[model samples]
Target: MPERKPRADALRNRESVLAAADALFARCDSPESVTMADIAAAAGVGKATLFRGFGDRTGLIHALFEMRLAPIRLAAEEGPPPLGPATPPHRRIPALLDAVLCFKIDNRHLALALEGTGGGSPYAAEHYERWHSTLQEALEHLPGPADSAFTAHALLAATRADLVEHLLGQQRMTRDQLRSDLKAYTARVLGSPASVD
Candidate 1:
């Protein structure tokens, strides 16, 4: 007998589940508050279906985050200046960090949920490796004595979703203020004091 692919209805259910989860995460104060049962209810699917589709809450959050990040990934890989490979490392680094900060700001709840304890260490994620590798390679081209690898890690760390949430929520830092601070801080790290514009 031939292997059977999942039914069309199953595929539809999976997408619906992910969409429902996204909505729930967006509205909730914390990712922990959005339970699988809540998502299953929202999607009109059974708990079993939700688990079968995503394995667990963490898996579901990871999938949703990947979907949201797809466009940004594409832009970074091939879009115009500041983000694309065609841009110089000095400029590209700040652009990349700024993009990351903006993304986190725009998707605070989802970003928070995805980076939450259930989602595990961001450092362990594949996307983190890609971002780190890109930044590390860029740092290598700079004239500083900074360890490219370590510097990349430190740079990315500055944009961690939890830290962003703390700054925005608890610290009450406005978006522009946060962006300027990050740009200035990134410039200092790169030994380019004049690039803080």
Candidate 2:
């Protein structure tokens, strides 16, 4: 059976909820502090609407995270060089990591909130799994016998939200400095062109 599209108002309410939730998370000191009631109040909808649309707090967070990550994912899936599949593995590998790192850096708070929902292990999250699979696929394209799965996990570990937050929030590392460090680390692992530095 064909699925029915959501009503226009329902869709609008969903967008409203996402935007409201995003603002609250961005402005709040902590992600957990932002609740469904807050989101519903901000969106001008009832808590029931939020629960009906998103199932729960975690689901809503995941949806919002995916929405924010759409642009980056689209670039990797179909966009141009350095991020798209057509690019060479070595270059693409680092580019993807750079993108993920930048995204987490840019949206650290929200990312941390989403990561926190992954049962205390960020690796268990669907978002993390998608990145892991993407990086692992890119890693496999390089020449050599490196274990792509392990290598991908190791590389991704450098960009986890908690670490990024600690480095940028508490450790006071500059954005450029963190990116440079990640680039260098990735280069050494892939023995790719970035390793020349």
Candidate 3:
């Protein structure tokens, strides 16, 4: 059997569909609000083609979230070197928080879409759990007592979706402020000698 290449026009249509979905998903209250018709109209494609490109609306949202989160995953995995005894806790801890804050700010819409409403799917839970574990691993390497795990959990809660949303929407704090405060609080919880005050 030979690999079949997609037709040039099909490729273009797929790109158009993805672009439309990205734009609509950002503004829609829920992923369900982004109908196939809306996407087809936005992309200048027929409804049938939209379905052909992305099976269903959930599939489209999944692809959109995956596309937006790829860079974040890479940054979390490789952006800052893992915390270690040789690494200063103040420096490495702040870097980790900054990385997550940046990711949340950059992908706010996609993250909201995935985990905001509709009771949230299993995918969102899995994503959050993975992040929690990654953060715990970083905290484990910090020069702290055996109870660093609890401290890590507390820090993660402070940097969670609800906190970020409140900081941005209600408190009107700049993204930099949230990132700074999170890092500062995390340092305090970890007992880092460098104080932000």
Residue 103 in model 1: lDDT = 89
Q: How many backbone clashes does candidate 3 have?
A: 0
Q: Considering every candidate listed, which one attains the maximal lDDT? A: 2
| lDDT of candidate 1 at residue 141, scale 0 to 100 | 86
Estimate, for each residue in 94-178, the C-alpha lDDT of model 1 and write its tens digit: 9999998998898888777776744367787767888899888888888983699999999999999899989999999999999
Judged by TM-score, which candidate is best? 2
Ranking, lDDT, top scorer first: 2, 1, 3
In order, what lDDT does every prediction score? 0.87, 0.91, 0.68
lDDT of 2 by residue, 48-164 (tens): 999999999999999999999999999998999989989988888889999999999988889999999988888899988988999899888888537999999999999999999
Clashes of each: 0, 0, 0
Model 2, residue 8: distance off in Å is: 1.6
Residue lDDT tens for model 3, 4-59: 99999999998898898889866766555777799899999999997787887666
Model 3: worst 10 consecutive residues (lDDT sum): 80-89
Collision pairs in model 2: none
- Stretches of candidate 2 off by over 4 Å are 193-197
